[model samples]
Target: MQESLRALLELQKTDQDLHELEQYKVDIPNQLETMETVQSEAETRLSDQESKVEDIEKNRRQHERDLQAAQEQVKKYQGQLYSVKTNKEYDALQAEIQAQKNRISELEDGILQLIDEAETEQETLETIRGETESLIERFGEERTTLESRLSAVDEDVAVKMDERKRMAMRVENQVLKVYDRIRRNLRGMTVVPIKKGACSGCFHVIPLQVVMQIRQGRRLVSCESCGRILITEEGLEY
Candidate 1:
């Protein structure tokens, strides 16, 4: 291939590499954000579980107090039964004692239910705590891996950009300018090979004469439709 055309092809390769590397670099922060969101959700779930357990425990304590107060009422009303003078008063005292006993029973049932619920909550909290720890560790490792990858991508992009600069310098100034402009406009493909007598970049057909000229590798040519620098497979080998 002609020296300028060969240099343009090399420059295109470098530019493509830089383009891909830069894209990857841009994506790293988003990856890290997603990982952080996962970790935050795990932590929030764990916190909610803990709070549920605490609320259950508090309710259980309140039920216990209610049971105690009901028992005290039963004892006080039972003591009043003996002091009552009339049948009506004694029956009222008995009724009050019975009501207190029923209230105690209800309180006991509530306390039992609360105990069961608290146990379940404790179990759930434990499970969630374990999962949270695993999530933290897993996300920690993922974040580290992503950070390392981001650093590596940065280094690779810097190297590729430096290589692109060198390759651009090898092409003729006017050709390099055109290549750079086309690359910027077309997302990094400025020079493309002819495949089946068509421009690979834009898939536009090349005339038979143009195909012959590109195959000779003696001069640089631009595609008529897309204006991308054109070469042939044979020209590349030459």
Candidate 2:
């Protein structure tokens, strides 16, 4: 019983190692997926910024054309003022010239504002581009490293699974069935050593008689409270 219990412990250790390696395999791909999401978002932001810059420049150019047309209108209105036939006609011409000048002033202000907006948008676009490029480069390096680690984890998991099987074969069939059943029911250690005169699995106190029985290593002993197979650490020492 003691030898079977020792073999079961070794099998459990191998199974735990295999479980960790499998989880690691999952975690690496999850990390890579996260990185891909980040890269996609960065690229989206950069593309949006570029569109903003392009729209701002397009609007700026349109404002410039409007400014030029307003200037030409002012010149044509001023020319009509000198050819006025009467005071009323001259007053009307003067008003027309003033209206065109005011429109020209407004167009000039709008063009200047558009220029400022275009400059700011262009700067933002460049910044986003730089950041996106750097992120892609960094993700590329990390992806390579993660892929390598994923392969290594696969190999380690395969080896640990084989080790678990070999160790499992050493345990008695009845004992192995009980251990596997307990492990399936619980997501933790199925076999535990006696600690401080208690079951380490659930901290349940053991009677002195049971402790003596466990120390003598004669028959299989189980903790009544947690239903865990109990062994003496000294008897199971590797």
Q: Estimate each model's TM-score.
A: 0.91, 0.87
- Candidate 2 lDDT by residue in tens digits, 162-234: 8888898899998998888888887678888888888889999999999888877777788999889988766
CA lDDT scores, all candidates in order: 0.84, 0.86
Q: 1-238 in candidate 1: lDDT tens per residue?
A: 4888888877777777777788888798898898888888989999999988999999999989889998999889888888999999998988888898999889999998999999888999999999899889988888899899988998898788888888878888888777777777775477888888788888999999998877777766889898898888565765
Give the Cα-based TM-score of candidate 1 against the true structure.
0.91
Cα deviation in Å at residue 71, candidate 1?
0.9
Among the numbered candidates, top TM-score falls to: 1
- The lDDT, on a scale of 0 to 1, for candidate 1 is 0.84
